[model samples]
Target: MNADLIIAGAGPAGLFSAVQAAENNENKKIIILEKNSSAGKKLLISGSGQCNLTHAGDISQFFDHYGENYNFLMGPLYTFDNHQLMKFFKDRGIKFRKARGGKIFPESNKASDILNVLLKEAKARGIKIIYNTPVENVKYKTGRFKIKTADKIYKSKYFLLAAGGKSFPRTGSTGDGFQIASSLGHNIIEPQPALAPVIIKNYQFKMLSGISLKNKEVSLWRKENLIKSWSGDLLLTHQGLSGPGIINYSRYMQKGDIIKVMLLNYSKEELENNLLKKIEREGKLNLLNLLIKFPIAQRLIEKILEIAEIDGSQNAAHLTRQERKEIIEIFSNLEFKIKSLANFNQSMVTKGGIDLSEINPQNMESRIISNFFAAGEVLDIDGDTGGYNLQAAFSTAFLAGSELKERL
Candidate 1:
């Protein structure tokens, strides 16, 4: 064979797997085909260039962050959890610090620091990384695999497809892995934008672009049925809604879905009672001044009043019963109909990938195709923001590498 193993795409998964395989057997010939000019293009831009590598909490807490396929990932994550992943870099002389929400990043606060360390490890292992060579096709017959690139086809005893999903296509993750897996008779879940911003059908919060709320309740609804509810920090964007609260739940969201955001962290009854008491006691106070007493930002409160068709400058005493009820409803339950997600270009990851059932969690190998393995966003696993996705990539890649080592 031209090489013992050929891994497609040099993102975190491919690079990490190559290092793991090489560390196990130094003489094994491993090649990584990276479509980009440099390795880890997406890795360098992750966490806005800081590269949140993993979360700080226990591994058990990670399961719920990954939506549906959480069970399928329990094996890999447990085998190579966050602590081990940290030690891998820490031993390599990279210092790490934990940020808010348990996100772990390099002490240098640079994503290049993370990418450089991975590249350094891969280089030290004698693994060959061919840049600017995209895998055009893959074919397996008679115990050997052929990987077709633009220039020529290369053969290998084992093949790993870690080309990533269709998020951030500019980073060379243009759903090539999904297409290749499909060609191999593997089923692929329809890829959708995950951790993406939501555009409202008639967004009126453009003026509150930078406004944010903390620990606010966010609910997802289809028609009149409540689908899911969670809480996180939210940011009002020029387009619509964003931040961890909305984007993290974007995987479960679709066009025309209604999202209810609690602008004030109080129930409708509580808000009505509180507002009525305030109006009765302070009849001369301006409506805006009364609302400002709540936890919400003044600008957001003004906009909410505007949306409710109530004048912020008007006195609380002047509000009719209907107007008071309308203002209270807006404050308690602000609703937005989702027009669309921000698309793959703006998404942090892809929601769906190769069907998890087709791959063994113990080995990360394709059950349908012998000697073929898959990992990272190429599989049907996408986690919440704040280092979960990267952690999943590392865990799954390590598992694949472990199995490859024994096979070699």
Candidate 2:
């Protein structure tokens, strides 16, 4: 074999795998191949340029963010929890600070600093990485694997595919990993856009374009049924909607479903009573004033009032029972018809990849192909925002790297 191991993709997973492999086996030769000119291009934009390094919490908490795949992550995450990852980065001279919601970012809050730290670690270990050389495909023969680029072919005894998902093509995560894994007898789950902004068809939302609601609960409903609800800070984008609440809740929203917006972040009963109390206290207040208390803009308030058939300038005192009910309906569950989800190309994290069942969670190696391994977003596991995805990458990479040691 040309090398002991070849890792595809140069993001956090691949880079950390190279570094870990070198540290675990001194005689092991590792090489990382990245399609981009420089490594960690995606890393440069992670956490909005802050490079949220890892989360600080229990392993169960980390896995819970992945929802259904929580159990599948136990082996990898327990092998290397978030605290161990933080210590590793600190050892590499990368300072991190805990931000809101246990999100740990580099103290400098620059993605470059985090990238530089990984680059330095990989370099110090004598790990070979080729830049701008995209892997065209991989062909397995007999037992070893063949890695083919545009102009060269490399053979390796062990391989770790970390090519990531289709999101962020410019950063080199163009679903190349999925193709490679599929060809290697691994099941490939169709990728979907998670943590992406939603498409709202209601033009009334256009009036709230600049308004951002803090601590608001956003829910998804299919046929007047409650599916998912997320409460956090939300922002109204010019196109439709975004922010923590909307983005998190969007994962459960399916095609052709209408999303309901609750600006108060209160429960069903709480919101109902709150609306009734407001009407009783300020009977003469304009509709705009009542909505402004809930964080929506005045123009959007007027639009909802229009949709409710209540005069925008009508005094709360003079409002009839019918008019108040209509207004209450609009406020309690503002329906923003969901046209569709934003495309995968613009999503923060790709929702699917290699199927988890085919790989051994304890080692992150292909169940069908012994010498083959998988890690990072290339795996079926994904997570919500606030440093879960990166932790998954690290945890899986650690398993792959550590398992390689025992195998040898």
Q: Write the per-residue lDDT of candidate 2 for residues 226-343, one digit (tens) a residue.
A: 7777667777777777887777656677777877767555665676677778878986797567656865667777777766667767676676767766666676677777777788
Position 365, candidate 2: lDDT? 87
Tell how far residue 206 is off in model 1, in angstroms.
1.3
Please, what is the TM-score per model?
Answer: 0.98, 0.93
lDDT (CA) per prediction = 0.91, 0.80
Model 1: weakest 10-residue lDDT segment is: 300-309
For 144-244, candidate 1 gives per-residue lDDT tens digits of 89999998889998999999999999999899999999999999999999999999998888878998889998889998999999999999899998999
Clashes in model 2: which pairs? 283-316, 283-317
- Model 2's number of clashes is 2
